[model samples]
Target: MSHQRRRGQAAIVYPTKVYTDSRGSRVETADMDNPIPVTAVFVPQRSSRAEVAGQQDIDVTRMIVSADVQGIDSWSRVFWNGSMWDVVVPPAYHHGTRHTRHYTMDIRRRPS
Candidate 1:
């Protein structure tokens, strides 16, 4: 199937930076560069209540983007539907027949 036919929404992927703060705590900062725009297919995989105190509901989704999309990794963050989702796993590349190529990854949205 053509990627365009499967695309359901537009998303912005923000590259992130991992750094140690003065207090020696690791921090993840997003928007390291101009956000990358891509058409993607978002599949709601699972949802659960946060186990940590004072945390909001947790939503996990599977995102599929065209192979042409680049610069996305496990450290990336995606903005969609008014929320920010962290890429929980490195993108898995899929090579299909007829030159169809895509990437699939799991993303999670947690309480800030």
Candidate 2:
């Protein structure tokens, strides 16, 4: 995370319902409300790579935001720079400092 501030937005997505599809497969529906304005720093962790088994590339990107940001978890979806990211790891305070400065989250961008 960098000390310089960067502007961004985050949206908290909630699972609205779960039902069966036509093929008897389970499906999930999520609802996203208005975006919440945020200021933070975007950090890219290790290099992005593809997973052969799942056939999905797991690109891990970290979002470092103020401790005040709330309702962000693995279920939440983040929108940044015209792209959406899945919150793979929930927000947490690094070094056990109780998020004195900022909290971080690990996000993954799946193939469209």
Candidate 3:
């Protein structure tokens, strides 16, 4: 269901798509008129043991603060046990968007 089209020396790329019928029994194919270019950048990390240790330290601090604020008195260093994160909320009520921060740090930092 994908093709490259050319007419009179003009080249065009289309993303052919598949569709399902209302009954969800029959499948149909349609040609796309325009092809969109999607671009993304990914950076690979090459870290030293020191950097890893620093990151782990920061993570530990953050988790401690998170547990303290959420009244997560009972926890396990290892997950999968019920008592681990139950200090914050009852095991049954664990749902919805809980308090968490989407944070980032710059790899380039001034030496302290």
In terms of TM-score, the best-performing candidate is: 1
Evaluated at residue 81, the lDDT of candidate 2 is 57
Cα error, residue 46 of model 2, in Å, equals 2.6
lDDT of 1 at 91: 92
Q: What is the TM-score of each candidate against the true structure?
A: 0.74, 0.62, 0.19
Which ranges in model 2 have alpha carbons more than 4 Å from their true place? 6-31, 49-54, 94-100
lDDT of 1 by residue, 18-104 (tens): 789999999877755769888788898999886898768978999988787776777789988888899998899999864468889
Worst 10 residues of 1 by lDDT: 1-10
lDDT values, one for every candidate: 0.82, 0.65, 0.23
Runs in model 1 deviating more than 4 A are 1-6, 16-29, 50-56, 97-99
- In candidate 3, stretches whose alpha carbon ends up further than 4 angstroms from where it belongs are 1-8, 36-112
Candidate 3, position 30, lDDT: 23
Global lDDT of model 2:
0.65
On a 0 to 1 TM-score scale, where does candidate 2 land against the true structure?
A: 0.62
Against the true structure, whose lDDT is highest? 1
